[model samples]
Target: MNKTLAEVRTESGYTQEEMSKALGIGISTYNQYETGARNIPVDKVKRISNILNIEEKDFFVPLKFTLSKIKKDE
Candidate 1:
């Protein structure tokens, strides 16, 4: 399943700049990640989880299996 980064951010009522600031990343970099133009780093992934008020594992479910595996391990 393909994930919708744009949808997630918008639904959380955040603009690219807000997300960038919250994650301590450049706005352009956050935009690229949301637009599928760049890969999101693992550190940013954790930050995104915090910003979106969701678990990191849930945030990544549609994009990967790693999150699920981590949850299982925990």
Candidate 2:
């Protein structure tokens, strides 16, 4: 899974403050988007994708996980 937004932000070496400045938004708002506390508008998502040099669809990569069966004790 490659949920690209946060990964791209880190890979680009931009702090939240820097990213917010680049996107013309407040740091708190950007943090909300990054932390999933707020849903980022599509236009903002596009701007962030542009700043990170990635396509907006890259943000949709799903997280990987697995479920295991638990055994019952007799």
Candidate 3:
């Protein structure tokens, strides 16, 4: 199974506040992204992937699978 953004962040030992500051965004905004309440922009996604030391593709593959599954279900 793929790890979530929150999982990766936690494993990397970063608090939401710290991540928000690093991203130059608000804590609420970061929380929203982590909680999937908002879609993170590609630029920010790249920054996040870099910060987490993971490939940028990690963020997108799960979403692609989910979208494809949803389409198939519909």
Candidate 4:
């Protein structure tokens, strides 16, 4: 969750337009979700996880090495 959805989506190679089409949602709505302007629903998050073949918890994983730093601090 430390990583923005836009960052993840891009790294995952999903364009906003493509994700919108795949999720049967509007582009603007998807944009809002990606930009953190809107809170993503659990069902949509699940669908995204399924589409990316990643676990829902993975979405909560920080990609910026913050977890590693915390572990080292411990």
Best by TM-score: 3
For model 4 the local lDDT of residue 3 reads 66
Model 4 clashing residue pairs (backbone): none
Better of 1 and 2 by lDDT: 2
Judging by lDDT against the true structure, name the best candidate: 3
lDDT of each: 0.78, 0.79, 0.88, 0.79
Which model, 2 or 4, shows the larger TM-score?
2
Candidate 2 per-residue lDDT, tens place, 3-72, comes to 5466678888988999999889999999988887777877887888888888877675334458899899
Q: Write the per-residue lDDT of candidate 3 for residues 1-74, one digit (tens) a residue.
A: 98889999999999999999999999999999988888898889999999999998778522333434344554
From the highest lDDT down, the ranking of the candidates is 3, 2, 4, 1
Stretches of model 3 off by over 4 angstroms after superposition: 61-74
Candidate 1: regions farther than 4 A off: 1-3, 60-74
Put down candidate 1 lDDT per residue, 1-74, tens digits, no spaces.
54577887888899988999988889999888877777887888888988888777765423444544344554
- Model 3 scores a C-alpha lDDT of 0.88
Model 4 global lDDT (CA atoms, 0 to 1): 0.79
